[model samples]
Target: MSTWRIRLSLFLNFFVFAILLNTVGIVIKRVIDDYGVSEAMAASLEAYKDLSIAVGSFFLASYIPRFGYRRSMLVALLAVTIASMGVAVITGFWITPVLYMTIGVSFALIKGAVYSTVGLITRDQGEHTSLMNLLEGIFQVGALAGPLFFSVVMGLHFSWNQTYWIVALLSALAYLLLLITPLDESEVQSHPEQAGLVEMLKLLRWPLVWVFVLCAWLYVMIEQSFGTWLPTFHERIFGLDKHIAAGMLSVYAGSIALSRFVMSYLSRRIPWLPTQLTMLGGAFVLIVSILLTTAGWQGTTVDSWVAVPPLAWVFSMMGFFIGAIYPTIISIVLNKLEKPRHAAMTGLIIIFSALGGTTGSFVVGFISRSFSTHDAFYFPLIPITLLALMLIPYKRLADRFHPASPGG
Candidate 1:
C-alpha cells in the first residue's frame, strides 16, 4: 500500500480540524462583541464542542477500526463541511453552538482515526513518536494559521461568520483527498469482535492508564486555558484591538509548532521523561514570571505589536515548552500497547482530553469573569505543578510495564 497518500490525507484532515477547533478563542471574543453574550455564556461554546467530542468518542471510537479509518475520516469531513456551510448561511448566537457541536463530534472521528492510523503506518516506537510529533506539529501549524485566517477575513470587511465559507471550502478539499486515499486496516480489523465499548472501557482497569489519563486531563486543562483564552487575555488584559489580539495567538501556536517539530528530531536523541520534565520546568518559570510582573498592571490600548507589552510575548512562549508534552505522552502509552488496541486506547485519551479542555475553559472563563483576566492566567499554575508531579510516576510505570519499549 502507498503510505504517503494516506499520510498526506491524515495531515490535511488534521489540519482542517485544528483550524476549526482552535478558533474557539477567536469565536468567543467575536460572540461577546457581536451577539452581546457574557463571558460565562460564551464559555458554553467550549462545553458544546467538547461535550460532544466526549460523547462521540466514547460511543464511536472503539468501533472505528471495524468501520474503517478512511470511512470514518471521510464521514467527519463531510459533516463538518456541511456544518460550516450552515453557519455561513445562518447567522445568530444560537447557530454558533450548533456549529461547534458539529465540529466537536466530527473531530472525535477524525482524531480517533488519525491516531489509530499512525500505529498502522509506523513500524516501531521511534517511528511512532516521530510521526506523532510531526502530525501534532502540523496541527499546531493549523492552529497558528486559524487566527490569522480569521484576521485576514475580517480585515477584508467580512464578518466572522463569513469565515465559515472558506472553512467549508477547505473541508471539501480535505474530504476529496481523504475519499481518494487508501488505508489498510486489516491488522486492526482482524478481530472485529473484540472491538467494543466493554473492551474500550476495560482500558481504565490498568493503573498506568488511570495515571496517564489524569496526566492527559491535567495537560489539556493547562493547554485549553491558554488556547481558548489567550486572545481574550490579549484583548482585555493588554487593551489591544480585537484583530491584533486574535492575530497574536499565532505567536503561541507558532511556538508550539516549532517545539513539536524540534521534538520530532530530538525524541530519538533524548530521554522522553527528562525532556518532558525540563520543558515543564521551563514553562513553570515563565508562567510564574509573567504572573508576577503583570500583577495589577493596567493595560493601555495598543494598536500595533510594537506597543504590545514584552511580557505578553513571554506569556505566549509557554506554548514552546508545553507543545511536546501531549504527543510525547501519547506516543509513550500507545507504543506500549499492541496495534489492535490503539484505537480503543486513543478513544480513552480523547475522552479525557475533551473533558479537560471543557473544564479548563469553563474555569478560566469563570475566573476571568468573576475576578480578572490576570487572575485567570494564574489557574494554569495548579495544573502545571500537578502535571510535573505526575510525570515521575508515569515514567516509572512506563518503564515497569514496558521495560524494553523505546518510549521508556
Candidate 2:
C-alpha cells in the first residue's frame, strides 16, 4: 500500500474537522449578535459540541480499530456533511446545537482513527512525533481558514447559516478522498478481541496515564479558552466588527499553524519538555500583559485590522506559544504505548481533551457573563500555571516508561 495516499487522506480528514471544530468561537459570536443569545447561552454551543466528543470518544474509541479506521473516518465525514447541510437549510439558533453535536460526535471518531492510524504508518518515535506535529499543523491551517472563511461569508452579507453549505461541501470532498484511500489495519486488528471497553477502562488504572490525562486536560482547557472565545473577546472587548473579529482570530490560528510546523522540525533536534515549558512561560507573560493592557478601555467600533488595538494583536499571539503543546504531549504519551493500545490511549486523550475544552469555554463564558470578557481572560492563567506544574511529573513518568527513549 502507498503510505502517501493514506497520509494525504489523514491530513484531509484532520483539515476538514479542524475547521468545523474551531468554528465554535465564530459561531458563538454570530448567535449572540444575530440570534440575541446571551454569552452563557451561546457558550452552551461548546458544551453541546465537546461533551458529545467526550461521550463518543469514551464509548467508541476503543472499538474503532475493530470497526476499521478508514471506515470510521468515512462514517464521521458523512455524518458531519449531512449535519452541516441540515444547519444550512434549517436556519435557526436552535438548530445550531444539533450541528455542533454532530460535529462533536463525528470528530470523536475522526480523531481516534487518525491518531491510531499514525502509529500504523510510522516506524519509530521520531517519525511519530514529527508526523503528529505536521498533522496538527495542518489542522491549525484548517482552523485558520475556518474563521477567514466565515469572515468572507459575513463580509458578503450572507447569513452565517450559509457558511454551513460550504462546510458540507468540504466534508463531502474529504469523505470521497478517504473512501478511495486504502489503509492497512491488519496490525491493529490482529488483537481485535483485546480492543474493548474493559481494556480501555484498564488504562485509567495507570498512574502515568492519569498524570498524562491531567496534562491533556489542562492543555486543552487553555487552548479552547482561546480557540472557542477569542472572537467574542475581540468583538466584545476590542469593539471590532463581527467579521473583523473573526478575521482577527485567523491570526491566532495561523500562529498555531506556524508554531506547530516549526515544532515538526525542532522536535527532532530539541528537548520537548524544556521547549514546552518555555512556551508556557511565554504564554503566561503574554496573557498577563494583554489583560492588563486592555483593562478599563471601553470598546470602540473598528472596521479594519489596521485600526485594531495593538494590544488586541497580542491576544492572537497566544497561539504562537501554545500551539505545539497539544501535539507534543500527544506524541509523548502515544509514543510510550504499544501499537495495540494506541487507539485506546488516544481515546483517553480525546475524552479528557473534550472535557477540558468544555470546562474552559463554559467557565470563560460564565465569567464573561457575570463580570466582563476582560475579566474572563484571566481564567486561562490558572490552567497555564497548573499545566506547567503537571509537565514535570508527566515527563518523569514518560521517561520511566521508556528508559531508552529521549526523556525530553
Candidate 3:
C-alpha cells in the first residue's frame, strides 16, 4: 500500500475498534443483572482485558520491525473476532467474568497494534498530529455509534449475549478489510543504533515518554469510568427509563466522538501545546462541574419516583470537549520518539492503558457494588485532576526534547 492507503486503512480500522470497545458500556448493567455476578467479579472482566493487552503488547512489541505492522494487525483482528464469538458460546453467570476478561485481551492486541501503526505512515510531527487526530476521531465515531447500535438491539429486545456475536461479526468484516489492504512497515531510518532493544528501553525511560504514557493511561481510565458506569449512573441518579438512560450514554459518547473529529481540524490550525491545554482546561472545569452537581444528591438511592437531574444534558455534552485528549496526547508523545521505537512504546503504553481501563471499571464497579455507584464519582476525580496537572510537565518535556516548530 502507498503511504496514504496505509494511513487511511489504519484510520478506518479505528472506527471498527471504537465500536467494539464502547459496546460493552451500553449493556454493562444488563450483563450484571442477567448473570448474577458480584461487582468485583464484574470488574474482573476489565482486569482480564487489561491483563491480556499488557501481555500481548509486551510480547508483540518486538515483532512490528520483524514481521510487519499489517500482519500484526491482521492477527489482532482475528483474535477480536474469535473472542467476541467466544462470549456468546459460553453463557454462565460465573463464566461471564471470564468471557469479559477475554474480550479485554482481544481488544488489547487489536488496539495496541492499530494505535502504534500511526508512526509508520507519517513523515513528520505535523503529519503525525493531523493523522492521529483524524483517525482517533474516527475511533470516537465507533465509540459513539456502538451504543446507538445497541440501543437498536435493545429496542428489538435482543439479549446481551447475542450482542457480542453482532459485534464479533463486524470485527470479522474489519479483519477482512485489513487483509485486502496490503501493509508495508517502514523504519525509514537506517541507523542501526536506533533499531535495537536497549535503544527502545532508553526511550521508554524518558520523562517525556512517561508523562504522555501516564497521561494517556489515566485519561483512558476517565474515559472507561464514564463509558462503563455512566449509563447505570444515569439510570440510577436520574429517573430515566432504560432506553432514555442509554440515550444519555450515547450523547456522552457522541459528544466525545464529535470533539475528537474536531481536533483533527484543530491540529492543522494550531500548535499541539495550546490545543491540548485548552482541552485539558475544559476537561478539568467540566469534571469539577460534574462533581459539584452530584454533591447534593441527598442519598445514593435511585428515586425513580422523582425527576432526573436537570444538568444531565450539560455533563453529557461535556464528553465532546474531553474527546481531544487521547489522540492529542499520542501525537505529542510520538513526536518525541523516532519511528523505530514507536511500536514498542505503543506496546508498553497499551499495557498500562489496559490496566487503567481495568482499574477504572472494576474499581468503580466495586465502589458501586460495595457502597453505591454514587461514591464512585469521588474516585475518578482525583486521577482526572492529576491528568490535567500533567500537561505542565508535558509541555516542558516536549520543549526539552523537540525544538520549536518551524511551520507550527
Q: For every candidate structure, what is the RMSD over all alpha carbons to the true structure, in angstroms? A: 3.6, 4.0, 5.0
lDDT of 3 by residue, 1-408 (tens): 377666666766676677765665444566678876666666666555556556666665644555456776777677667766877677776555555555555555555466567776667777777777787777777777776676677788977667677778877877877777765554533433444345546666566777777888788888888877887877676556666676677678778878877777777778866666677677668767777777656534344424556667777776776677787878777767666666666776776777788778888899999888777866877777788789788878786774233211
Candidate 2 C-alpha lDDT tens digits along 161-256: 799888889899889988878888888889887577787887776677888889889988998899879999998888999888867777888898
What stretches of model 1 exceed 4 Å from their correct place? 24-46, 89-98, 158-162, 229-243, 295-301, 362-378, 402-408
**In model 3, which regions exceed 4 Å deviation?**
25-44, 82-106, 148-169, 188-201, 232-237, 241-243, 289-310, 358-385, 402-408
Instruction: Sort the candidates on TM-score, descending order.
Output: 1, 2, 3
Number of the candidate with higher lDDT, 2 or 3: 2
- Per-prediction TM-score: 0.87, 0.85, 0.78
Error of 1 at 268 (Å): 2.1
Whole-model Cα lDDT per candidate? 0.86, 0.86, 0.69
Q: Please give the lDDT score for candidate 1.
A: 0.86
